[model samples]
Target: MDDMKKLLEEIEKLKKEIEELKGEKEKKEFMESEKIIEVIDKIEEIVKKGFSVIEGAVIGSLEGIKRSLQEKENGR
Candidate 1:
């Protein structure tokens, strides 16, 4: 009878420990996912800014070319 009681106590202790471990794992995973999302958001912002700069440069170049062609025709 004493052995059975001891066995039950041990099982209860083990269950609590397992529950703690599972809680810690879930917390860690949530933290890691948050960091990953932050990094992805930063990357997206940088990409959008880079494309905007490229677009501006392309438009400026086209405008310059058009002006130069108009001046040449005026000269002729």
Candidate 2:
């Protein structure tokens, strides 16, 4: 009977340890996902900035062309 009691206690302790390990695993996974989200956000910002720079360059080029045309007309 004493041996049976000891066995039961050991089993309960193991069960608790298993539960703790599961909790740790979940926390690790959540942290990894958050990191991935942060990386994606950074990439999105970089893409937006790249587009803005390209748009500015295009607008600047158009304005330069317009000025050149006006100068030629005035010269004539």
Off by over 4 Å in 1: none
lDDT of 2: 1.00
Give per-residue lDDT, candidate 2, residue 67. Answer: 99
How do all models score by TM-score? 0.87, 0.83
Error of 2 at 18 (Å): 0.9
> lDDT tens digits, residues 21-63, model 2?
9999999999999999999999999999999999999999999
Shift in Å, residue 21, candidate 2: 0.7
| Candidate 1 lDDT tens digits, 1-76 | 9999999999999999999999999999999999999999999999999999999999999999999999999999
The residue ranges of model 2 lying beyond 4 angstroms of the native Cα positions read none
